[model samples]
Target chain A: MKKLIIASTSTVHNSGYLEYILPRLTSFFEGVKTILFIPYARPGGISYDAYTAIASKGFETIGIQVSGIHEYNDAQEAIANAEGIFTGGGNTFELVNQLYKNNILESLSKAVLTGTLYLGTSAGSNICGVTMMNTNDMPIVYPPSFTTLGFIPFNINAHYLDPDPTSKHMGETRETRIKEYHVFNNTPVLGLREGSWLEVMGDTITLKGNLSARLFQPGKEAKELDSESVINL
Target chain B: MKKLIIASTSTVHNSGYLEYILPRLTSFFEGVKTILFIPYARPGGISYDAYTAIASKGFETIGIQVSGIHEYNDAQEAIANAEGIFTGGGNTFELVNQLYKNNILESLSKAVLTGTLYLGTSAGSNICGVTMMNTNDMPIVYPPSFTTLGFIPFNINAHYLDPDPTSKHMGETRETRIKEYHVFNNTPVLGLREGSWLEVMGDTITLKGNLSARLFQPGKEAKELDSESVINL
Candidate 1:
C-alpha cells in the first residue's frame, strides 16, 4: 500500500512555514520519529543545509526530526532507510536536475511505492505527477528528462491561481499556460490551489484541504473539484 | 550589422495587436517588403495558418506583407532569403522545438547576424538572448537545448513584471525567479517589461519605450535601466 500527502504549498498567506498543515502532518506522520528530507529545490536558492533546517524546524513542531538527503554519504541508502520522507518545494527544474544528478530518482520512487511514509509540497508534490510540464517555475536548469515519479496518473500545477479579472498584464495566465501545455501533451493536469492537498492511501486519492481544485483535460473544458472529492482521474 | 526590434510583447493592455509599437516597427522595417513569419509558438495553440493570418493582419497595417515559414518549400531557405523576419509571441518551448526540428536555428541566427532586419515579440525576443533558461514559460515541449541565438550577451525575461506589494500570494515573484536562475546560471538577465523594447543597430543596443527595464547580474543588486538607456551588458 502507498501513503502520501502531496500539498500545493508548504506555507499559505499569513502563516509560518508548514504551519497551516501541521496538524494533518502530525497525524499523517504519526509514529515516525525521524524523516529524510530532500531539499534540492532550494527555494530562493538557499543552501541545502539551510533549506533542510527550515524543514527540520517545521517537522520539529510535530515531534519529528528531519535530516537532509545531502547530509548522507549514500542518498539512495537514506531514501531506502527513511521511515518517513519529506520533499520540500522550490524550483522544479532544479529539483528534477538534482534528482538525476544524485541518481536517486529511482530509489525515491521505489521507496514511496513500497509504502515509506511520504510528504511533498510545491515542487515536491509536482513530481508525483506524470511530468514537470505543468510547473510555473522558470526553467533555471534543464533536467535530463521531464518524466517524474508518476505516483499519480496526472501532472500537477502547484500554487495554481485563477486569472485576475481586472489585471491588464499580457503574460499568459496560469490557465492559459496549462492550455498551451495541452496543445503538446495528452496528460491530464490538476491545478492544485494553495491550501489544498491530496491524500493518497493505496489506490484511493482524495482531495484533502478546504479549497476546491481545478482540473484540466486535453480538449475539454476545465472543471472544479470540491474538497474531499475522490480524484480518481 | 544586426538590426532587430526585440519587444517584450506584441500587445499592451487595452490596445489592438501590435498597435502600441506600430510607428517604431514601420521605421525599423523600412524598405522591407514581405517578412517571413515563424508561427511555431502558436498562441492558444492556434493553427499555423490562423496565427500567420493574425501576423499578416498586423503587418498589413504597416504596409508590409506576411508569409508564414510553414508555407515555404524550405523553411531554412525562407529564413536565409527573407528581407525581414518576424517571430510572433507564443510558447517558448514550442518555438524552440520547431526551430530545432526544422534545423533552422543556425540559419536564422546567421541570417540575422548577416544584416537581415528582424522583429521578435515576447518568446521570439527571448531567443535573441544567450539562453532560454530565463524564460517564464511553461515547458510545453522540450527543445534540443536551452542555448539560443546569443545575439546579445545575456538572457531575457520577456513580459517581465514587478512584484505586487499588496498581493499575499506565496508564489515566487518574477524577480525572485530570476534570482534563482542566477544561482545556477551566470548570464545577465534583462527583465523586459510590457510596452518596453530593445533596439539593436549594428553593435549598439538601446532600451526603447516609456518604462524602465530591470537588469539582473549575478552576485549584484538589480538596477533599473530607463528608457533610451544603452544596454551594452
Candidate 2:
C-alpha cells in the first residue's frame, strides 16, 4: 500500500515551516523516493539552488514547474515515477489556479486514488476540501471550486490561527469565517493551525500539530479535536 | 414588463443603509404589485411589524421564510406572484447561504434576465457581482463564492469606506484589501460606498450616492468615480 505525508507548509525557504516538518519527515518517508511539487512557489521564483537546498535535507527532490497544462507532460511523469507527492505552500488560490489552468488537479486526484502517496501543505492542504471558496485569501478572483482534488472529503482552512491580540479591527474572526462557510456548505471544515498536518495512510487520519483542530457541523458550535486523538469520519 | 429593485440593504433595519429608497420606491412602484425577498434579513428576524413597515412604503411586502430547498412551494409562489423583486442586506454570506440552500439563485437570475426590476442594497448589492466573494465584511464565515446569482459580470466590494482615523490596528486597510484582490482576479471590481446605489434601468447603470465610488482592476491603480458613469460591463 502506498503511504502519504501531507504537510501544512514547505520548509524549503520558510525556515519556520521547515522546522515544523523536517523532524517528522525523516521517518515519514524513510527509504522512499520523494518528488517535490513546487508549483506553489512560482511567486518566489524557481531556482536549482533553492530546489537543491530543500532536497539536501534528506530525500531526493525533483521540482515540477506546473505553470500550464501544455507543460503537463513532466508533471504527469513526476506523479507516475514518485513514491509520494509533496505539495508546498504559497497561495492556495494561485496554486489551484495553476492546477486548473494546466488541467492537472484531476490527474493528481486520480493518482492519489490509485495508491500514489499524496502530500499537501498550506494552500495544497486547502485544495483537499470540497471547494476553494472558503480560503482566507481575497475573493476577487474566481477559481474552479466545483470539485476539489478531494484527497480529503472536507475543506482545509490552513494557517488557522487565533485572532492576534495586537491587532484591533471590527472584521469577523476566523471562527466566524468558518461559520459563514457552514451557512452554505454541508462539508465539514478542518481548521488546521500553522505547524499542524494530517497524515493519511489507507483509511486512517492522524492529526499532528501544536493546536487542536476545530470541526464545525452546520448549525452547531465548533468542537475541538480530542487530545491527539484520531477520529474516523 | 416585469420590474425589480434590489436595495443595498433593508431600509427598516441595519445601519449604513439608505432611507432614500423608501419614499421614491412607492412612487416608482406605484400601481405595480410586488413582493420583497427577505433572504438577507433572516438574521434581523422578519417580524410582521418589520415586514409591514417596509412593505407599507410601497406596493406590498412579503418575507421569504425559505431556510432550505424543502420550501420549494413557498419559494416558487413568492417569485411568481411578484411583478418585481427586492433584496435587502444584512450579511452577504447569510443571504447567499440561504438562497443557495433553497436553490433559488438561478431562478432569481432568470427573473432578472426576463426584465424583472431588481434593486439591491449593501449585502444585496454585493451579490450582484459574478462572485459574491468580494464582500468587505471579512470572512466571518465561508459562503459559496461560485454559486452567486451572477447578475453582473464584475465583482463588487461593497460598503467601501476609508479607514477611520480614530482607530488603530494592524488589519489591512480597505485600500489594501482591494489591491490584494487584483493580483489574482482579472475581473474588475467596484467598491460601492455606503449610501451609494448602482441603479440598472435596462442596460443603463447609474452610480447614485453620497460619495464617489472606487474602482479596482487587475494590474492597475485604484480609481475613484466622482460623477454618474455607465459601467460598460
Candidate 3:
C-alpha cells in the first residue's frame, strides 16, 4: 500500500521550517531511519546545501537522518535506496525542471508506488498530482513538460488562499483561477489551505489538519471539504 | 514608429469597462476608424463573441468600430490589414496557446512592429513583453512556448499587487515570485499596478497613469518608478 503526507506548506505562520508538521511527519515516516531530500525547488533562490540543511534540522528532531539528492552521485540510485522521500517546496517549475533534467522523475514515482514513505510540502505536494498545471508558483523556468508524478488522482493547489472579501485587486481570485483551469482541464483540484494536508493510505485519501479544503470540480460549483473527510475524487 | 497602450487592466475599481481609460484610448487611437479586437483571453470563461462585444461597446464610445479577429476566417490576414488592434485580458496561457495554435504569433508581432496602433490590457499587455513568463494567471493549458511578441524590451507583471503587510498568507508574495523569475532570467520586469500603464511611442516607454509602478531588475532591489517616469530599462 502507498503511504503519503502531502501538505499544503511545511511551515505555518510564526513557525520554523517544517516545525508545524514535524510531529505529524515523525508518525507518518515511522520505521524510517533516513530520508532522501529533494530540495530542487530552491525557495528565494536558496542554495541546495542551505535548503537541505533546513530539512536536515527538521528531520533530526524526529531522529531521522536526512540526505539531499544532490549529495549522491546517482539521483536515481538515491531514490531507489531511500527509506523515506521528502521533496521541499520552492518554485514548482524549477523543481519539475530539475526532476526531468536529473532523469529521476520515474524513479521517484516508482519508489513511492512500491511503498517507500513519501512526504511533500507545497511544490512537492504539487507534483504528487496528475499534473503541475494548477501550481500558483511563477514559471521561473520552462519545464520539459507540465506532467508530474501522478501519485494522486487530482491536482493540488498548495498554500491555497481564500479570496479576501475586502480586497480591491482586479486579478483573478484563486477560485477564478481554478475555474479557468477547469475550462481546459477536467481534473479536479483540491485547494489545500495552510495548516491542512491530505494523508494517503492505500486507495483512501483523507483530509488531515484543522482547516477545511476547497474542492473544485469541472462544470460545478466549488465546495468545501471538512477536515477528516475522505477525498473521493 | 510603434504606438502601444499596455495597460494593467481594462477596468478600474467602481468603473465601467474601459471607462477610466476611454479618454486616453480615444486620443491614442485617434483617426483610426476601426480596431481589430483579439478576445482570445476570454475572461470569466466568456465566449469570444461575448468578449468581443464588450470590447466593441467600449470602443464604440470612442467613435471606432470594433471587430473580433475570430470574425475573420484568416486571422493573419486580419492582423495584416488591421488599422488598430486590441487584445483584452483573460487567461494568459490560453491566450498564448491560441496564438501559437493559429500560427499568428509572428503575424501579431509583425503587425505591432509595422505600426498598427496596439492596445493590450492585462494578458494582452503581458504578451507585448519578451515573454509571458511573469503573468499572474493560471497555466490552464500548455503553450508551445513562453516566448511572446517581444514588442517591448522586458517582461510585464500586469495587475501588480503589493504585499499585504498585515496578512498571514503563507504563499509567496508578488515580489517574491518576480524575484524567483529573475533567478533564471535576466529580463527586467515592470509591475504595472491597476491604474498604471506603459505608453510606448517608438523607442521610448513612459509609465503613465497616477499610480507609481515597480521595476524589478535581476540582482537589484526592487524600486518604485514614479508616475510619468520614463522607463529606461
Candidate 4:
C-alpha cells in the first residue's frame, strides 16, 4: 500500500522548523528509525549538508535519524534502502533538475509506491502531483521535463494563499494563476493552504489540517474542501 | 541606437488601463504613426482580437493606430516594418512560446536594436531581459528556452513586489525567489516595481517613475536604485 504525507509547508507561523507537523510525522513514520532526506531543493540556496542538518534536527524529536541523499555515493541505492523518505522544499525547478540529472527519479517514485513511508513539504509536495506546472516557485533553473512522480492523480499548489482583498498589487493572484493553468491544462489542481496536508494511505486520501483547501477543476468553479474531507478528485 | 520603454505594468492601481503612462508613451513614440501589438500574452486568457482591441483603444489616445501581430499574414514582415512595437502583459510562457512558434523572436529583437520605437509591459518587458527566468508569471505552457532578447545586460523581474512584513504566509517572497535565481545564474536582475519603468536610449538605461527599483546582482546584497538613476548594469 502506498503511504505519504504531502504538506503545504514545513513550518507555520510562530513555530520552529517542522514544529507544527512533528506529531503527525511521528505517527506517520512509526517504526522507521531513519529517513533518507532529499535536500536538493536547497531553500535559499542552502548547502546540502546544512539543509540535511536542519531536517535532522526536526526528525530528532521523533527519535529518527536523518541522512541527506547527497551524502550517499549511490543515490539510487540510498532510495532503494531508505526506511523512510523526506523531500524538503525550495526551488522546484532546481529540485526536479537534480532529480533528472541524478537519474534517480524512477527509483524514488518506486520506493514511495511500494509502501515506503514518505513525507513532502512545499516543493517536495509539488512533485507528488502529475506535473510541476502548479508550483509557485520561480523557474530559477529549467528541468528536462515538467513531469513529476504522479504519486497523486491531481496537481498541488503548495503554500496556496487567497488574494488579499485590500491589497493593490497588480500581479496576478494565486487563484488567477491556477485559473490560467487550467486554460492550458485539464488536470485538477488542489490549492493546499499553509497548515494543511493530505494523508494518503493505500487508495484513500484525506485532508488532515484545520484549514480548508481549494479544489479547482477544469471548466468549473473553484470550491473549498473542508478539513478531514476525503479528496475524491 | 536602441529605443525602448520597458514598463512594470500597463495598469496601475486605481487607474484606467495605460492611463498613467499615456503621456510618456505619446512622447516616446513621437513621430511613429502606428504600432505593431503582440497580443500573445493574453491577460485573463482573453482572445487575441479582444486583447488587441484594448491595446488599440489605449494607443488611440496618443493618436497612433494599433494592429495585432496575429492579424498579419507574415509576423516577421509586420515586425520588420513596424514603426513602433508594443508587447502587452500576460503569461510569459505562452507569449514566448508563440514568439518562437511564429519565428519572430530574431526579427523583433533586430527591429528594436535598429532604432524602432518599442514598448513592453510586464511579461512583455520581461523578455527584453537576458532571460525569462526572472518573470513572475506561472508556467502555463513550456517554452523552448528561457533565453530572451537580451536587449539589456540584465534580467527584469516585472511587477516586483516587496515582502509583506505582517503576512503569515510561508511561501518564498519575491526577494527570496530572485536570490535563488542568482545561485544558478550570474545575470543581474532588476526588480521593477509597479509604476516604475526603464527608459532605454542608445546605450544608456535610466530608471523612470517616482518609485525606486530593486537591483539584485550575484554574490552581493540587493540594493535599491533611486528613481531617474542610470542603471549601469
* Fnat of every candidate, listed in order: 0.85, 0.18, 0.70, 0.70
Which residue window of length 10 is worst by lDDT in model 1 chain B?
A: B142-151
Which prediction has the highest DockQ against the true structure? 1
What DockQ class does candidate 2 belong to? incorrect
User: Residue B1 in model 3: shift from native, Å?
Assistant: 0.8
Q: List-wise, what DockQ does each model earn?
A: 0.88, 0.14, 0.80, 0.82
Once all C-alphas are superposed, what RMSD does model 1 give against the true structure? 0.7
Indicate the worst ten consecutive residues by lDDT in candidate 2 chain A. Answer: A62-71
Candidate 4's TM-score reads: 0.99
TM-score of candidate 2 relative to the true fold = 0.64
| Span of 10 residues, lowest total lDDT, candidate 3 chain B | B106-115
Off by over 4 Å in 4: none
Q: What is the C-alpha RMSD of each candidate to the true structure, in Å?
A: 0.7, 7.0, 0.9, 0.8
Misplaced by over 4 Å in model 1 are none
Q: Write candidate 3's Cα lDDT for B1-233 as tens digits.
A: 89999999999988989999998998898899999999999997899999999999988888999999999999999999999999999999889989999999989888888799999999999999999999998877888899999888999999999998987778999999999898889999999999888999999999999999999999899999999899887
Q: Is candidate 2 or candidate 4 better by lDDT?
A: 4
Model 1, range B1-233, lDDT digits (tens) per residue?
99999999999999999999999989888899899999998998999999999999998988999999999999999999999999999999889988899999999989999999989999999899999898889998878788889888988899999999999889999999999999898999999999999999988999999999999999999999999999887
Sort by DockQ, best first. 1, 4, 3, 2
lDDT of 1 by residue, A1-233 (tens): 89999999999999999999999999989999999999999999999999999999998888999999999999999999999999999999999989999999899889999999999999999999989999999999989888889999999999999999999999989999999889888999999999999999999999988999999999999999999999987
B115-148: candidate 2 lDDT, tens digit per residue: 7666666676777777775775423334455447
Candidate 4, A152: how far from true, in Å?
0.6
How many backbone clashes are present in model 4? 0
C-alpha lDDT values of all predictions? 0.93, 0.59, 0.93, 0.94
